[model samples]
Target: MAMTIALNKAGKRFNRDWIFRNLTFQFESGNSYAIIGSNGSGKSTFLQVISGAYHLNEGHCTWTDGATLPVEKVYRHIAYCAPYLELIEEMTLLEFLEFHQHFKPFVAGMTPKKIIEEIGMQAAAHKRIQQFSSGMKQRAKLAQCIYSDVPVLLLDEPCTNLDRQGIDLYYTLIDQYAKNRLVLVGSNDEVEYKFCTQRLNIMDYKSF
Candidate 1:
């Protein structure tokens, strides 16, 4: 498989101090990776750069070899799930799903009903997001990400608010959906460790 993402001599700084520097990595298609680090490390920053949410301060992040796509174009092929992103409060689960699907062309096998049934959120499908519990909201987010048919996935703390069964649901989806694309997860959960094929640790600037 060709390389999909690359960060060469990458580094980021807030104001006066370096968060991480001289960092390099290459990600290819058809593999899954997990990023683990201490809380203040640059894990989220690195993901944002790879996901094109932030511009690098030095060097550059590149997407190459496979489809000749730029960062945003590559991002279009990605489904990112982060706790900070808020869903539409007024939209029902079904409506919210339709909202997200508007970002790209629809896939043949992806249906909201299937996602609803799989995540066990059928009853809440018609309800507004503001009415959902934390776990329910997490389920809705999970359903949205998986149903989008985007191959590359960046999940930040994927199991938040999920019960044992809900966590199982995440693992099941990873097994089913991560066939041809790359999945990168930022998590410290032991269960997540089991599914990770490789681990990348974000070392703090102090440690470097």
Candidate 2:
């Protein structure tokens, strides 16, 4: 089934300040898009809004897979990874992936063992997340999202804690998993979103 996300005059505000307003766009499955903006711009917020994580302050956003899907159910169809999203520090690498499978099954043919091997964290599979380095934690986050069987993938500052090798791993994961999915990346770095065919600058939609 084809998934589609439509934002109709969407806007978000904190108190009296509008982050972005009257923004309208549609995202269809099988295409990748980049949401670029300055650090203070609403790139991440917009991604969250479309991912059904945050409610729009004005107007609305909707999800469709042949037919409109309920907003509450949208999360099941999305795999989101962001710098601000925290992993369970108490769970071991293997345990976390096993637990995640209960809620969201991995993409076809992806198992917990495959994920740990692909992320190059096989040695630390039994180690708790809290003991992992920042880069390792970031790898785990990306692994979870990338390997999930979801139609929509939202990535915000995906390479935040990654080093050169870690960045390379990110690209490899995306190259293998992002096909035929709605992949939206929020970042100003070209390398992070080079695969995206479309770009949206949040600043362009801002209204003073």
Candidate 3:
């Protein structure tokens, strides 16, 4: 079944300060989109709204397969990764993967061992995440999002701490795993969103 997400006249505000207003867009399966804006321009806020992490202050967001799905069930279809998202610092790579799979299964043919090899962190699989470098932590975060068996992928500042090699690995993973999914990348860098065919500039939707 194809997945679809629609935002109907969506708007969000924080304490009388409007971020964006009357935004409407639809995302369909098998396509990739980039949400672009400067710092403090509501790019992350918009992605959060689409990911079902935040409620729109004045509108609605909907997720659908063949029929409209309930809000509570929408998250099962989404895999989200962001720079500010906290990882379990006390858990080792293998342990974290094991824990994550209990809630969200990996894509077909993916296992913890495979993930470790794919991320090139096999030697550190047993090491706690707090011991990881920024780049390594970013790689781990991206791996979980890219390998999850979900229809929607919401990535905010995906290359936050990645080096050149790490950035290259990210694109390779996207080519191998993100095809046929609803991929939305929130970023200001062109390199981070070059693969996206469609672009949504959050500044264009702002009412303030």
Candidate 4:
């Protein structure tokens, strides 16, 4: 059993309002976690903190295992996707995938061509992201995220802008890709929660 992520007394604040205080948890490898909370419960903020997109205001986030490395070095193993983040509108879908591939050193055999087909974006692969519909753009973004070959994937509201069939695609990918990796999903959808092996409910963090 390997420990993948640990949150040690982690706290964050915006202005005077404390989003979460004294939060502590450990996520083990080979498991999927669902973070359930209401709107503005700091779900996205927490995910960003764990994903190293934002620095913590207090405490620290640490990866307990796997070749003692710096934060940036460690983040090379993390693939993060969120509905709030937008794709590069200026570039075509294929071009954008190539651009992101440069950051991932482990994606040796992985190519955007097969991923495009998997995500049902083969026809739209050459089109500019700006011309894509919301669902199309989401699928393109998802394809990029999965193609990274990162051991950990953090998804925030992953079902956003997805239709019924598109939503099914998300679940299927997670099941296949999450093996032996840590997956964190921040969602309110009950259907999404069913896939998680563990569940964490973040209520009023300020209270504690």
TM-score of each: 0.91, 0.98, 0.98, 0.91
Q: Write the candidate numbers in order of decreasing lDDT.
A: 2, 3, 4, 1
Q: In model 2, how large is the Cα lDDT of residue 143?
A: 91
* Shift of residue 62 alpha carbon in model 4, Å: 0.9
lDDT of 3 at 50: 87
lDDT of 2 by residue, 1-208 (tens): 5799998998999889888999899999999999999998989888888888889889989899988999899999999999899999999999999999999999889899989998899999999999999999999999999998999999998999899999999999988889789999999999899999999999998888
Q: What C-alpha lDDT do the candidate models reach, one value each?
A: 0.76, 0.93, 0.92, 0.79
Pairs with steric clashes in candidate 4? none
- By lDDT, the best candidate is 2
- Number of clashing pairs per prediction, in order: 0, 0, 0, 0
Better of 1 and 2 by TM-score: 2
Model 3 quality (TM-score): 0.98
Please provide, for model 1 over 47-137, each residue's C-alpha lDDT reduced to its tens digit, 9 standing for 90 to 100.
7777888887787788775556676666677777777768898999988887777884334577766677778898998999999999889
Model 3 stretches astray by more than 4 angstroms? none
Instruction: Give the Cα error of residue 31 in candidate 3, in Å.
Output: 0.5
Tens digits of per-residue lDDT, candidate 4, 43-67, equal: 8988888787777789988875665
